[model samples]
Target: MRRTHPANMFVCECITQSLFRLMKRKPYNKITVTDLVQEAGVSRNSFYRNYQSTEEIIRQFLEEKTSKWWSEFIAYPDRYPHVISEMFYHFLDMKEEIDLLYRAGLSHLLMEHIVLCGRQSLTGELKGQLQRHQLMKQNVTEDDSYEICY
Candidate 1:
């Protein structure tokens, strides 16, 4: 039988849950993949297979949680402003993990991912709104400022 990806049920959950619990008690830097694996009763290979590094895990965890909120935000555009506010608050709440990942040399990657996600989401929403207003034309010239404004 083929072994399942550790991320599906065992290793990733263990690592993430352990990290979440430990993060409340101490700084992220103090925690290690070994600690997580030990706490979660897994092996180093399992951790490695699921995550190249601890920073990757941290980024994935943050992204996963944020994606849920993002989905909810998109579902209710009237609460979009509140969603943005909550997003910032969530960032603040994860400051320790963010700081740890940054210190571990993953700051640039994490920031890029965050910015890319935000830009993609915004662009998608704008395109949807334009289409909804019937303002999006199939044959728009690049020189047209009307399309640019939209």
Candidate 2:
């Protein structure tokens, strides 16, 4: 059955919290859907209704965080001067989640999300803006800038 929006969000939040909590105590690879559901106090069917895999959970979390960071990053008028530092600080704020990702051998998902966020920029504005701000003052192409990021 289809869940109401709020109910779905509640289930998602429960599962996410449970996953993070479990990650703190065990290897992510060792945690199964049964473990997650039990920890979340949610039904296995509820977990499956919102996500297909544990990786999807992490991916969704990363996407939400990076997307929010990008939005807030763009809102600052003096963003260019401190963009790099701000980016690092933003990630630092998510250190726990990042640590979990690293411990889980899922660090690649972080890079993937970064690339995805870059691609989502308006008409490559993210790359172009960074280049204009001397991010790649060495005359690197947009594609090359991405390589530098990677």
Candidate 3:
């Protein structure tokens, strides 16, 4: 088994929270690793142990957030549409951090992951819609076609 680095684990959580907070306030590029470590209350060495650079930390954060959103959406399919809207609101809410990540050139990877997840979610929703449509078609009474068409 591989041993986990304690410094990395600590720094990771700190950076995640700090970035989350920062995203709520300002653009991402405006923030620095120095700021991150200071806000996280961790030493520079601790931050370095887990991440070679701030961009790496941001990338990891984006990946984790995207995965979390995906899990939540899957868990409650009935709320998927609302979840998507919430995700958009989240991005708008975090515009500052997102801008910083984009300036750092890490947004591409993050956006790609998000887009892939969105595609998967959309495909799943479409499939469900098609199945429901098929069921409704099969159960249609003669008068139902006129009602549906009208």
Residue 83, candidate 3: how far off, in angstroms?
6.8
lDDT tens string, model 1, 62-115? 777677766765565444444345657767876776776665565786676666
TM per candidate = 0.59, 0.78, 0.50
CA lDDT, candidate 3, residue 86: 67
lDDT per residue (tens digit) for residues 71-128 in model 3: 7655664554444466676568567667766765667866766665545543445435
Alpha-carbon runs more than 4 Å astray in model 3: 1-10, 16-40, 82-86, 102-106, 119-150
Per-model CA lDDT versus the true structure? 0.62, 0.74, 0.60
Name the lDDT of candidate 1.
0.62
**Regions of model 2 farther than 4 Å from truth:** 1-4, 122-142, 145-150
Q: Indicate which candidate wins on TM-score.
A: 2
